[model samples]
Target chain A: MARAAVKAQAAEPLDGAERILQILSESARLFATTGYDGTSMRDIAEACGISKSLLYHHFKDKDEIYARITLGSTRELYQFVFDRLPEGARPIERIRGFMVATGEYFQRYRWAWVASTTAFWNDPEQRRQKERMMWRDRYENLLRGLIQAAIEAGELRPLDVPLAGRLILSSLNWMHRWYKPEKGMSAPQIADAYFDMILNGLKVEG
Target chain B: MARAAVKAQAAEPLDGAERILQILSESARLFATTGYDGTSMRDIAEACGISKSLLYHHFKDKDEIYARITLGSTRELYQFVFDRLPEGARPIERIRGFMVATGEYFQRYRWAWVASTTAFWNDPEQRRQKERMMWRDRYENLLRGLIQAAIEAGELRPLDVPLAGRLILSSLNWMHRWYKPEKGMSAPQIADAYFDMILNGLKVEG
Candidate 1:
């Protein structure tokens, strides 16, 4: 009988990986809307219309699901931008491309970005700590490299690369908090506005 | 007998104002850390070592408490900065004072600011909507006035004042998402950094 039960469980159409993804997505939305500590495992199961036992089978707990979702987001973001950085593109074009891609990502995956950022401070567990560090390092390195190249090529002003990188990223990242799709401006339009502001300033050139 | 009961209830050392403030402060912390829907009356009361009945006495319900806290924050912010804007001050100095005061508010009431912003999107109930609209109007008006004054004074190059105002507020608001008191930077330092970036670009002058 035990063997039969095991076989039935294994043969179920709901595989662990699929179940995990569903849980992560639901949890991400809830966390983004409600917050990490605010969401419960029961919330995820109900949102998914699955049994608690079935949900547990896919993942150990909530933190595990949160970590997975955040890691996936960070990975996807890094790959999306870094993979397309053409070797021979001018610094101006490169920076613009990066900003555009970032704006698009913010528009597309607004919830995930919100969840990751909101949870960063609240969860100081060791696992979360490591994840935050890893995510920050990846972005810092990529941005530093881009800014350094721009400065070397005389395509950009010589500024403190690290601070400049933080400012640029912070400006772009802030969009998720306020950008509404219902608004008339598309992501590309917003990106263009930001690009113009960063390249120049509010002052119209003489 | 009813009068006596009423008198007894009123006589309990529970200062309505003080009790309400305590509840608001606790709720802000929980909401900032957990999220609005994640916090409950029981949780809040427990955190304050009071019964849920006492909580309800001061607040009609959770939404009321949330609205009160948010509205209170906006009132405090407006009071802090508006009072400091001197009539004869240069446009740049006025802007700086605004930024510095805003940074101080965030530092002192970090949880309240975070809760207000995060809850604005997550909860769109009537009360939240009212609070959000009030905040939006205040911010828009303040920015519009600042930009006009700056332009009139020739401190800022002419551009879209409304848009510029939104962008400036957006950048400043994003600070709560990442600002940490323990991160080796005070509120003043962060405000200074932002002010410098806005006044001057990262590029060294040719």
Candidate 2:
């Protein structure tokens, strides 16, 4: 079998990480479509076109699947935003780049966003909820720190640091509700418009 | 037993609309605590300390109860914001008043805010979903019109009108996720800070 695998790489279409991501991505859609309680491991197994045993091998239970989705999505999202911004970019530019990458990813991973919106704070499994919130706080604090640096450097105006962080992120996060790729406002355009509001302030430059 | 024939004045505690509101508000909390799918009419009945028949008598089903919660909450929220503002107030004052009212209500009715965050777009009951979105659009348009008026009157900078509206409301709506009454920041204080950022511009006088 090892020799045959080496001879025909296409036989195992997806590598291990890719296979796991595919399972997670597919399960996220299901969890989004049906409430978390409404989705079962058998459902995920069927959706992934794998046997139930294989599904368990990948995920011990739905709670683990959900925890992975939440953590994975959060980590990937933070990495995508930070990595996409070129090092040494101005703080304001860094913000715009982060928003653009985030908007693009939100558009692409609509299901994951929806899945995260589910109420995990009150989850019966306390560990999963705590794990999710830990990552969330990390994301919030890092973003808030970037904004604070801009304020300190005089690149941005001083305001309530925590509120500013929430404001910027809320605007971007709400995109999943209304953004339509077919509607023709590209993600980059949205990033520009949002930055316009955030950096320029809504009151016409006095 | 049909009201005890004009018995004690305090015998029947709540009036018709008030009674319904009480039920909806309680159910909203349960829905927030437990996923919508996890909630049952029997559970709502139990939560309200009423018989299942009485609960059904008021709401034909959970869909009806949910629809009422969404619509009632939206209508009350809109009225709260608009009614709180005095006629002919300056755009800045009007905006601040509106924010304060909204923030107060979001904190007060935390459960309804959580309920609205749930993914109703793909709800199995399409009618309930559409009914909710219609009110949502009405709220959005009303808010957008107020912002446009501000821009036209030179109170606000000319930015993307719709985007500005979304940004402001999104920031307010997200309060449920993070705001806690015991967090030392009052709802009105949060509102003032938000209005400060939105109206005064975040950038130091450029």
Candidate 3:
């Protein structure tokens, strides 16, 4: 009760953006562990230490909270990876950037990522078509485009670009399911194993 | 209506094993498409052309249906791969066998795999612990062990065996998400791409 009062007091003077951020962070934590379907708006309100009406004043419902968080997080993730790239980074380095960025991002925002796993899109064909491109597809295409560029430059061998992109992303994505901090492999170190295998190739030279 | 009637008649004379197989197969198909939470006993009965009492007579509930199908299927999948392993086959071929077997199995029994995604265990600590090992961890351990064997025999490079297993299995596990039989990549063909990439690695030789 005391902590709730303090949190409410701390949030009271903050602007709408800060209040929303606080709400989203708390909502993300809930969604990651309990799942989206398992959570309720009332639960979010309680976690926020705000009234249901106050939570609604910020966002209409749980869906809105989920959409805002996922879209915002994905946009930020893409930016984080792109922002770190050296102006003339080699193809290998660029690929490394992607794998490392993805692994670290999943590690940092696991709950949000897990929450995003639930199916949320339900709309007409055309709208769903456009929604498909918004985040997940765009992320995949970004990886595919990098692989294509590398192959064109002869920095990487010719392989099926789309398949290769999916393969690398698959490995990285599954890390969220099994990665443990206690296992002694940092996100970068885990990423390094994948990066090294991809760059070095697995075959022994004759 | 006629087809359901025919299926019901077909099962009338079957032994318990065949009757159970029929129920599990139909249930797996339903669970794959409609999802476990979405599927109901009545729906399974309608699909199987059996009464609710008859369905209950065979299995207690949805959870029983799920466990039977998943365990039976996983056991079969393991057997399928192991049966195909030739004496003195190279380490790479053995790995290929796992990938192809997994891809084809997912292609064939995708609904069962999807159904197994939901939680079924409800026991206190120890049962849940065993449940975890019974399915996912056991599978991961199997792959990791194969990778470790390859590494020990110097048939493969020394690297993180656990990471490699997850990476390979991830690509295979993810097939149900995007695999389309009509899209030109057969299960074996898709597995080939993964088998090739993982075995040869993706980087071009200098």
| Candidate 3 C-alpha lDDT tens digits along A59-98 | 9988888776766556556765667655588877788888
Task: Judge the docking of candidate 3 as incorrect, acceptable, medium or high.
Answer: acceptable
Return the candidate ranking by DockQ, descending. 2, 3, 1
Ten residues in sequence with the least summed lDDT for candidate 2 chain B: B1-10
Q: What is residue A46's positional error in candidate 1, in angstroms?
A: 19
A141 Cα displacement, candidate 3 (Å): 1.0
**lDDT of candidate 2 over B40-141, digit per residue (tens):** 988777655567887787889988887778667777667666777757987767777777888876765556666666553235666766767776777778
Please provide, for model 1 over B12-105, each residue's C-alpha lDDT reduced to its tens digit, 9 standing for 90 to 100.
5657654564567678888766878999999888766688888887787888877777676676567666876666888877777777778776
Model 2 chain A: ten consecutive residues of lowest lDDT: A1-10
Off by over 4 Å in 2: A1-27, A30-67, A120-125, B1-23, B30-67, B119-126
Question: In candidate 3 chain A, what residue range of length 10 has the lowest lDDT sum?
Answer: A115-124
DockQ, all candidates in order: 0.20, 0.45, 0.44
How many angstroms is residue A127 displaced in model 3 relative to the true structure, after the best TM-score fit?
5.3
Considering just chain B, what TM-score does every model have?
0.70, 0.73, 0.68
Candidates in order have lDDT scores of 0.68, 0.71, 0.70
**TM-score of every model versus the real structure:** 0.65, 0.74, 0.75
